[model samples]
Target: MLPCRNRTGKMRLGASIESRPAEVETRKTFGHWEIDTVIGKKKGKNAVVLTLVERNTDFYITRKIPAKAASAVNSEIKQLFSDFGKKPEKIFMTLTADRGLEFASLAELENESTKIYFAHPYSSYEREINERHNRILRRFIPKGTDINKISEEELERIEDLINGLPRKRLGYKTPEELFNEQLDLIYRL
Candidate 1:
């Protein structure tokens, strides 16, 4: 593919941009999330999988979207954070996403104190934790399946099962334990 540029004519490296400081700045808790969407089915279809990864604990939250556009992603993310609570504090700090137009309307998704940051395009590896969780999810929900039929409850159960699994990085502890401990530490501050 040819290089795509921003309005300035400077080369925009699709998803190859790096913004590690922004990620570091916003991750205030174990639950601070990195967000991405996977396109399923045929091209230009209305199916999407929203993936969120907790920075510190490596726990993930996956929600299936009926549409794959930016507006659809923004709204779904807003609803997901709202489910955490109406308050902005529970919404965690930073959300790192790729430069896809699906997240083009990120500003609209921002609540009072929540900040949004974009990672470089095609750099899903930068968000490796989420990528790993994506693999785990594929065991239950394969790629290219019509994601719209998966209910919210089933998605939650999948999230639960993934979180319940022990991780060697955490010395065989579950994400639940690591996440809770990190939250407790944050609360103590």
Candidate 2:
């Protein structure tokens, strides 16, 4: 794809990953997240999977978006605002995304409570959380499998199964468990 540019043709990107807080790298805090899109066909307007993995607890979210377009992702983000409910800021403290044109609008979501960061071009390692989970996700939906063909319910089921699995990384605790604990604390405050 050609570079995403403005009317004046200036390529647009958000705050550099370098600007991200040092604490984010340590993964000791809740709410920091890594986001990405998983696409099937390289050719069609098929649906894509929007994946987000919480840096701290490994809580994963998968939403089947209409397409790999800015509008679709933005709409989904708006939908998440309602899903996150009364205080989205507590759950969505910071978002680290790639320099995809579709994510060009994500910077607009930044405020006092939420910030957006972009990894350097070609640097997928910076967002390893999304990468590893996407590999796990690939077990259910292989590469090149048309994401649009998977029903929303099935996708959600796959997510639930993965999130329900216990992990050695968290001392055998499932991601959902730790995630719920964080939610309890956030909502309890």
Judged by lDDT against the true structure, how good is candidate 1? 0.71
Per-model TM values vs. the true structure: 0.77, 0.93
Which regions in candidate 2 have their CA more than 4 angstroms from the true location? 1-10
lDDT of each: 0.71, 0.92
- Per-residue accuracy of model 2 over 59-137 as CA lDDT, tens digit each: 9999999999888888998798679889889899899999998898998878899999999889999999899999999
RMSD for all candidates, in order, please: 4.3, 3.7
User: Which is the leading candidate under TM-score?
Assistant: 2
- Regions of model 1 farther than 4 Å from truth: 1-31, 182-189
